[model samples]
Target: MKLLDSGFRRNDNKLFFLTFYDIASPKTGGNMAGKKKGRKISGKKAGLSPGSLVYVGSRTDEPVRISIMDYDADRIDEIPEATLDDIKKCMARDSVTWVNVSGIHDTAIVEAVGRLYHLHPLALEDIVNTRHRAKLDDYENHLFLVLKMVIQEPETIRIVFEHVCLVIGPDYLISFQEREGDVFGPVRERLRKTKGRIRKSGPDYLGYALMDMIVDHYYEVLDQLGEEIEAIQEEALSNPTAKMRRAIHDARRQVVVLRKTIWPLREIVAGLLRGESKLFQDGTMIFLQDVYDHVVQVIDTVETYRDLLTGAMETYMSSVSNKMNETMKVLTIMATLFIPLTFLAGVYGMNFKYMPELEWRYAYPSFWGIVLVVFLAMLLWFKNKNWL
Candidate 1:
């Protein structure tokens, strides 16, 4: 049950490191433990109201980090960390403002941001509950998007699942994450350089960029998984041990979880493409469509991996069975060769008063000679029959 490796990249400040549980790693309490954690999280809100703000995830004491990027065609302001006053000033500007919250374990941070943006209480509730699935909810004034961002280590194939929520308004977009590091670094760089149409676009287009970055990273994860699947398949065909079978099953379960986590984003993206919310502009629908295509490709890759795992399991079982059959065939041939020898010895072993062969001078040597001849004859017959 030793884990593959830790895939997360720790920050230099070392404020806090996020813990990512893999469905494939047994040492990290695979699917059953995930279920128990889910139940425990649900119990925390058993008696609470629907809109009650409760952090339903791993508890941490680290302070939440808030960063902002306010940009228009001409100028862009980047704040590594912003205070509420700074956020207020950014809100006053007539530009696309992006507020990124690094952690959501604190209900107060979410509550404060909710109040500033006039977000629905239910939306705030979903934001704090980190286990929510990928979805889209429209609240007339803005759109709420929940997504699971998958991060995989290139060398170890270790995967981390992070919860991402986006609340897109007319001129601003607020994003909430469970931890500090993200794939959004590229999107932030693009914003800083004023690259492409992102600088001239609205919040909807920026939202698309963030989601697109996440979806594109899925290819990297899938590539790692693809190599792992090939390795497992080779091991199953060659070794076919008990441990290999477990690896195959664990891999299949991982693929299932990946499929479930990513499948919903397709509908969410398609909803945006169909103009389900006014927050998404018509100019951004084409880009959203591209994101939708990426989601489909990710889904297809996941499906293909699932099938490959199934075939690996079958191959493992077949290899094991064929091995057993060979062992049983050799044992049967050995027993068949001994049958005549045993009968001859039994006949001579009878307590006869005067047995001709028992009294012979060379009886024992001749008996061994006959036994060797019979053994060689049977072996030759078996070889000819191709059962050897």
Candidate 2:
């Protein structure tokens, strides 16, 4: 869960360095373990609720770490720890510098970075508050972007969501992740190896590369969901148990959650592409368009899965109805066969000695024969009617 960043300039130099430590590091004090216990607080004290600091990203209390990558086409320099002096040095250099910070639990460090870059207080607030939705705000000097990075657990089919904030400045890019694990490994490797146009592009392209990685993960999650939906469909058809019903319901719930996460993302990316922002360049619009397309694909896939799950629910209901009707049909036919036979038994069990059927032994045999014949006749009728 270490953090790293690679910076590339138009001139082709690349610098790479690790930025932060994982939350489990000793410095974090294991604050991410569970919910903080407390008594109910009212009025001003409520503002200090432990949950006030929304744990929108990771539950880690890791110390904030920073790294700087300064590079130009000819030469590159990597600084493992990017202090205020390092930022000033990189700003004075004739290269593209990328400062990456990991761990947002420390508000002071966040404010310091904001102050160094002359970032707006609102943007700084958004940075410190990890629960903010995915968004892109354009300031004259830079673009502030908030995005959620999701990872699917292989064993549980559960998703863990994290927030990654980006500040695209004039000559530099600053990325902040709530946790240490980042999906930007490919982008890092590409920058390090000088693969493709990454080194040749500007800072906006770097922002696109990072955004593109986040969107790519949306596809992976949808793919996993598609598999799960297919399994639920099969289970609903073959053996519609109560467990299967619950599975369908849970699948639908997940679809709802996925929709909530993805639908707004479409708008956010679309806003970035449509609006005029200093962070986005004309050449970078095409990349943003690609990301936008990916968002649309993810949305469509989510919707399709939702529709399929709904159909499965209907099918399950129909199956249950058919089973109930079959059970009732058997009970009805048994009742129909016994009605006349029960009447005959009642007549014979009567205590009246004057009844002619009770006078002789032959009469008793005759009454039994009549009862048997009636029972057989009712069976034949039921069979003919296909009620058997």
User: Which is the leading candidate under TM-score?
Assistant: 1
State the TM-score for model 2. 0.80
| lDDT by candidate, in order shown | 0.79, 0.70
Number of backbone collisions per candidate, in order?
A: 0, 2
Deviating ranges (above 4 Å) for candidate 1: 1-42, 154-157
User: For every model shown, what is its TM-score relative to the native structure?
Assistant: 0.89, 0.80
lDDT of 1 by residue, 258-368 (tens): 798889999899888878678888889988888998999999999999999899999999999999998898898888989999998898889999889988999999999
The regions of model 2 sitting more than 4 angstroms off are 1-59, 74-84, 362-372
